[model samples]
Target chain A: MAQLFYAADLFGVAVFAITGALMAGRKSMDLFGVLVIAIITALGGGTLRDVILGNHPVSWIRDDTYILVASIAAVGTVVWVRLTQPIHEKGLLIADAFGLAVFTVYGTEVALQHELQLSTAVIMGVITGVAGGVMRDIICNEIPLIFKKEIYATACIAGALVFIALRALATPPWLDTGVAMLTVLATRLAAIRWHFSLPRFHLLDRD
Target chain B: MAQLFYAADLFGVAVFAITGALMAGRKSMDLFGVLVIAIITALGGGTLRDVILGNHPVSWIRDDTYILVASIAAVGTVVWVRLTQPIHEKGLLIADAFGLAVFTVYGTEVALQHELQLSTAVIMGVITGVAGGVMRDIICNEIPLIFKKEIYATACIAGALVFIALRALATPPWLDTGVAMLTVLATRLAAIRWHFSLPRFHLLDRD
Candidate 1:
């Protein structure tokens, strides 16, 4: 089970790193800038979550493997994009969905282990699932997708709710995890396919 | 001494919050958007520092006062601007310098309390002083001022180094704190007055 979790985490890291590198490429950033953005997108969310939970040394700082994987993924992304023009939009979206699903479940599990309240744990899951992308977009001088009427954070919230509900029913842990991941993946992918989005709030206009 | 620290912290929060609200105003964001940006700008840096240092419950989360002050400041900014056209740039800069000075000293004190290495403590101080503004700029879809050949972060670093030196000399804690604050405030103000800036990195251009 631990090995499975580790593998999934690495996969998520690589996917997120690639996305970050692609963003940097679009911005015409240098190699160092690309690498920095990739690392931040791969680890920023988890680092924030751990720090908020008072888990010291942070995961990547404690274990070098995460950084190593992200670096390789970033370099590979730069090379691939340089050789092949642009990445397919659909493919990138699918990969991002996978990362979001895996990270949401992992973040929820970690928060639960720390005995946080259910509401807080769910929020933590959403934060972990979206913060990296948010940070990447912000650094690229763009408004964060999650904050810009996207259904992204909503998908994570739905997944976290499913996880909490399954745990309450005493479902097997593996089954609960699987269900949560599927929920997030499906919701996110469906949203992308259908061009679904949350309604924008306009307080000043209303007044 | 505790009262003085509390006053300084509150002043910093108000100054930062106003800056965030002003940025939001420039972007033509609504009231809610302005408030959200203001809160993030006021508390984001300290939150990041605390989380990185494995300090749980985060200071703002532990105490409701920070949130209260930030919200009030945000609302006040919106009202002030609505009633009076534009915020005075000079006034804003001075307030920001006050915030930077106070936060740099306060962050250093907190890191030192945790017995961090001198270099680490100094870095923490700089992070605390600048991260909020960095976040504000990012969320507003602008390049961070600190990263754009500005003398901003350098001022914080200078103050932190001064703080560390004073501590090594076994100076009175109050004196040390005062000197550090003065150093940051003076440097920042002087830089602004003289239009001083750091050299920009142009690696790609040079190549």
Candidate 2:
């Protein structure tokens, strides 16, 4: 029997893909480049998780639905971008936060299933969720925000811990996912609102 | 006894890490960010291989030298970047290509050791060699050249195929490694010099 979690995950994946496509449209990339970014934004996290756990067939490759959903969303986003003129830079950050939150919960849930410890699951959650964004930034020849002394990845980690806590309290799975996503979103929003940042810790002297 | 091939691999890894640090330095990333990029660039390919193969103690985690070498290189690169302002972008690309060639041959060798078929070995080689750059580019928030109708990955595939053919002809092990590395370097250099690009395949309809 298919569960509600699966449905939310599909929604998350679609939105992430759309966000990626919209972002790519800001550049002069061809359709394939847009598609590649879209796929990375949507499915890259789960791919990392599966690879880490040594799972077979890969998550998206196992069921074609993920790819199908992302492709459709990508095409839709491309159309939307062209019609809307240009994607707003500020709005893009908000959508990216949503993607990170949803993916963090899903990643943690998957890691727990793999018998990884709660701490490891939480780490994996943040890593899988934000790592795609990190990768996306790197490919674009920009230093990732995570390393830019931003409070970005910390929100994902905090949210993941919230998810684990709720699950431990016997919270319904839906509530857990929602709470986790909200935690991430709220933390991220607050960070942006207050310009939250992690203090730089430089081990070596830099002139 | 560790052979010349082994020594070359170490040298290539350190060089790759230095190149990665140089790329990160372009953005004035803090020391940690520079170090992280360099280390990831150096270890990313081999780590993917070990994870996919379910090899215990993922490559860098097994040998302290990989980490030490990459770290030293990263530190050196950062220092150089500080001493010399505004590195040439082309220099980084050439260094990256050199690293890619080395890793492609080594990746295929590892796959062969795992008794994988030629096609699988070639695919693995390409993945190991190019995924790091793809990951780096994504984190930098740029459209990866990998998906940009480029001949970068194609060169790796061609070089891998050459290695397989030579090995099948009973070439000596060290000779095979040397031949493969040289072939990869030459092919990549040619592609870069000639501005070689793959045929653009567009599956998306224009809006």
Candidate 3:
């Protein structure tokens, strides 16, 4: 079970790192910039989570494995982009959804382990799922997708709430995590497919 | 002494909040958006510092006073802008410099309290001084000022290093903080006055 969890975490990291590198490429950033963005996108969310929870040393700082994985994924992305053209938008979206789902579940589990309130735990999960992408967008000088009308953060929130409810009902841990991850992945992919989005908040209409 | 420190902190918070509200005003954000940005700009740096240092509940989360001060400042900015038709650029720059100087000293003090290495402490001080503005710029979809040719972060680093040196030389605590704050303020102001800037890093020159 532990190995499976680790595998999922690594998979999420790789996907996010690739997405980060692709963004840097699109912006025509240098090699160093690409690697920095990739590392931030792969680890920024969890680092924020651990920091907020008062977890010291942070995960990547404590164990070098996460950084190693992200760096390899970033290099792979650069090579692939050079060999074949840019990755299609659809493929990137799917990969991002997978990362969001896995990171949400992992973040929730960590918060719960620290005995945070369920509401706070759910918020933490959403933060973990969305913050890295937000940071990536911010660093690239773009508005964050989550703050837009996109249904991104909503999916994470839904998954986290469901996960907490299942745990409260005494469901098996693995089953709970599985259901939550599936819920996030399905919601995100469906949103993309249907072009579903939240209504924008406009205080005043501009010309 | 504690009261003096608290007063300086609140002054910094108020100045940063006003700057945030002004940025939001420039972006034509609504009242709610203005308030949100204001609070974020006032508290984001300190929160990031605390989180990175494994200090839980964060400063603003632990004490409601900071939020109260920021809210008041944001509203004041709105009213002031409406009445005065925008603050002068020079005035805003001075206020921002004041906030940066005070926050740098405060952040260094916090890092020293944690017994961090001198270099790490200096870095933390710079982060705390500039992160809020960076976040504000990012949220407004502008490139961060610190990352540009601006001498902002450098001033913070210089001040932090000086503060650490003074402490190492057994200078009085208050004197150390005072000198450091003045150093930052003077460096920043001089840079603005002289239009001094670091060279920009351009991986590829655009046509």
lDDT of 3 by residue, A1-207 (tens): 777778888888998998899888889999989999999999998988887777888888898999999999999999988998868877777888998999999899888887776766776787788889889988897766555434677788789998999988889878998999999999989988987765322222122
1 or 2, greater by lDDT: 1
Clashing pairs in 1: none
> Residue pairs in steric clash, candidate 3?
none
Residues B1-207 of candidate 1 have per-residue lDDT tens digits of 777877788888988998887776666664555666787788888988987787788766556678789889988887776666666656666777888999998899889989999989998998889999888888778778776444898999999999999988999878998999999999999988888887776666553
CAPRI quality of model 3: incorrect
Kindly list the per-residue Cα lDDT of model 1 for residues A26-132, writing each as its tens digit.
78999999999999999988987887777788889898999999999999998887788877767767877888998888898888887777766776787688889
Candidate rank order under TM-score: 1, 3, 2
lDDT of 2 by residue, B1-207 (tens): 146757777877797797667766655555656666777778777778778778755555445677688879998876665666656666777788788888898888888889998888998888778877766666555566566544788878887988888889988887887788888788777777787776776698889
Q: How far is candidate 1 from the true structure (C-alpha RMSD, Å)?
A: 6.5
In terms of lDDT, the poorest run of 10 residues in model 3 chain A is A198-207
Compose the digit string of candidate 2's lDDT tens values, residues A2-51: 37767767877887887778667766679999999988878887787677
Q: In model 3, which regions exceed 4 Å deviation?
A: A30-33, A204-207, B1-43, B52-54, B60-133, B143-207
For the candidates in turn, chain A alone yields TM-scores of 0.93, 0.91, 0.94
